[model samples]
Target: MQQCKLPSRQKGFSLIELMVGMTIGLILVAGLALMFANSSQSGNELEKSIRQIENGRYAVELLQEEISLAGYYAEIPLHGIAYSSPAACETSALGFSLTTLPMPIMGIAASNVSEICLTDRLANSPAFVIHRLSAEGAPSNPASAALGTTYVQSSRCSADGVPFKAATAGSASAFDLKAIDCATTNPQIRRYVSRVYYLASCSECGSVSDGIPTLKMAELRGTTMVVAPLVEGIENMVLEYGFDTNADGQPDVFQTNLSTTAGADKWDNVVAVRLHLLARTIDRSADYSDSSKTYQLGAASTVSGDASGFKRRVYTSTVRIVNEAGRRETVSYKPASSP
Candidate 1:
């Protein structure tokens, strides 16, 4: 018993071995952490790219939707309306009068009209206005119409008004145009639509300089123009209008400014519009490089140097003025006279 047992033979690792193992474990953990960080960074970059693309597409689509409705006054667009040049910041009754009703679309190449409802418009970007009738059916009769809101009603009967009726008073006499069969008792109305779309240089700096560019709208709400910001990261926008010189609804020439383009001031003859939007990521990406790229936007080209760190892409859309072009689509074959 006293002899007892042999000394316990348990072997322990040396301090060097323990230190080595810990070092390897630390190295593996560090590598994994680095990998995770890179993955997270990539994910962020992808998200930014997707957001940029979405914003660009949405901006283009919104513009197209508004443009399609240009010159759309229900059944009649130019019954007796004359082509008139729109002045900057003109939103009064005189601006929307029947005499100048033919101007459904207007565009400015430079930010010359900076005093318009939108002063934050970006320089070198295009601003355009669209005039149309609301797609929704307004009050059935002028007496039931909303007070202070302008409405346009098309006359199906030639006995009433030749084309349509435009009114704001909530009285029966306001609506002179009637429905088919000269049903003066029952009249359909459409709300007036006026919208100005432009690129604004405002951002979350607290800001649009170090801030992201945004697509903004100055819409005619009641008697005043209400400005609202829409899509973000829209760096710039350029537009060209397709003019129907022969009145056949087909575009014969594309021009930049509707006011000063060659064979100019034909607002009613515009059949199509081509738009180019330059969009960018809201945040600068360290991985992106565009030093060699020069963006071509409509009639203007971007400056060659790209020192801005934000990633950018261009979006283009060509939209036909449905209400303007569709009415001119009638095919008439002229037969030889009684030969």
Candidate 2:
């Protein structure tokens, strides 16, 4: 009886073994869906290349810390003294000054504007402008001026500079006619940092329809300039100065068009600052394709269009104008009358 029944057992799955077990379970489910779509496109291209190298090294360390604080005019006196007035701080409404040659950095190349220092260039790309003289306040006084956030200090003879905050609280004769002789004793407040650094199409990570290519700056605050939006796939920003064209302090050539009515004395012989930037990756990369690649920038410029399909990185830096090459090789023209 057992022998007869056993032969009938093969009647269950024999349609060629159910088509080879359904073609090996549909080829192991299409090889696990192509290895989970290539590991989710390599984890979205390593998280968009680590957010484009952390937004291009935080926009090249925030323009190398504002280009080493360009011409930080803190000690105040900038060469020979004889001033009757006007060192002009307190957001000089953008006319900043420590008295010439402290040009403290400036640029414009790439659609070549024409104007140099005080805003208005930045057309197709490249930009700069630093100035400096901030980070040192709190002393306050002059009737506690505080309109746009007061800042002024004078006494000890005074030379001028530090007048903004709605004329140090609306009229002390317009804050001693724009700072410097506040006479409230040795007060000493300070705050005036000019910035600039361009490259915009707007994008702090949203808005402007996310065309993403930010990096913008501006900043002044008092009389108001304020731009903001820093770093976000910073698409481009050339800037090449370098200069010292022979005054010695270092740096020899590198230009990229200067301004303020042409080379404005090569912007105090710049001293150093090459920076290139470029950075990109605001998404868009089916698996990469910088279209034959090019991306030049500093060696006389490049990067024109069709930036492939995202994912880029250039970032460079030369930076060194540390307070104009850390000056003071014996130049103090005054202040010795009281030891």
Candidate 3:
């Protein structure tokens, strides 16, 4: 009888029990949803950061390549002229001798000549040119002259042959005739190879204008030719020059303005260059305004435009001019007696 009564226990779950079970299930579902949302947000941020880093790295690489080759001339003698010639007095005897006569032509240099002058091939052209002497020695006889006779002529094209005019305050055309004479002994003996630096801004990823993106170039030496895009989302670029004034083998001066001042020389004394770039993301999705958290570019300073709720990133790099011609004293001038 007692066993039969015990068997009459509850056949269905009570309301309290049912409510407890349902609450537990709801909590689990909510936790899973929260985790998925967090994961998705994290993935998006990671992608954006990766893209920013890649763009920055690409820009730095391009700038480094060009800057390092700031004074790149062909290995040939005539082509090795400095971009900026020393003053007539300071010109080295070696440099003066190296500049003798028209390049490559034997017997071109007469004993009367004390120095030589040559224009930079890349000075006013969109690309570089090589104006050089054949070698160092006395002019050979007629037959040898023909064999050793180096002539002043245009070198082969190594880059796109787009015609470009120099940005200097001169009326010279892109293909104007420039001469080199084997005379003059001054620091100005070097050919002044101008550097072209620029910045481009784009709202869309791939939009280009007039075959040129929206970019601004500083110290443009040649024609206003279109520049290739280094990377996407590059907003602005600025340049600074470092001068080794004391010749202590280290940079001493830092300048943002490259233009000449009233009394001070322009960046002509600059032996090394430092480049800085500012890049940003086209689209940001993360809520980056959290006061308790920090990200790249320091604690989010004032958010901008619709980006108040999204992430913002910036990158910077510095590169020295490795191939600077002005730094080459050995090849700057020819010996006095060599002429």
Question: Backbone clashes in each candidate structure, one number apiece?
Answer: 6, 0, 46
> Judged by lDDT relative to the true structure, which candidate is superior, 1 or 3?
1
Best by TM-score: 1
User: What is the Cα-based TM-score of model 1?
Assistant: 0.86
Give TM-scores for every candidate, taking all chains together and pairing residue i with residue i: 0.86, 0.36, 0.48
Clashing pairs in 2: none
Q: For model 1, what is the alpha-carbon lDDT of residue 197?
A: 88
Candidate 1 on 1-339: residue-level lDDT in tens? 377677988999999999999999999999999999999999999999999999999999988888988877666656456656655355665255545563678776574765568757777777887877787544455666778777777778868645666677566577776667776544567788778888788744242255568898888777778888899999877788898877777888887755654453467778899988889989888856788888887765554427667888889899999877887776989888995
Clashing pairs in 1: 201-208, 202-207, 202-208, 203-207, 203-208, 204-207
RMSD of each: 3.8, 17.2, 15.7
Which candidate would rank higher by lDDT, 1 or 2? 1
C-alpha lDDT of all candidate models, in order: 0.76, 0.63, 0.38
Instruction: Give the candidate number with the greatest lDDT.
Output: 1
| Rank ordering of all candidates by TM-score, starting from the highest | 1, 3, 2
Which digits, one per residue and each the tens of the lDDT, describe model 3 over residues 1-339? Answer: 455444555689889999999999999999999999999988887887787777767776866665555433333233434233322212222122233321110011112122112211112111111122222343222222222122222213324232111112222121232223323111111122322333433323244432212223222122222233446655444455565565443457755443433223233345555555455554555555534443332222222334344343445455554443244334347568863
What's model 3's overall lDDT? 0.38
Error of 2 at 92 (Å): 29
User: How close to the true structure is residue 114 of candidate 3, measured as C-alpha lDDT?
Assistant: 26
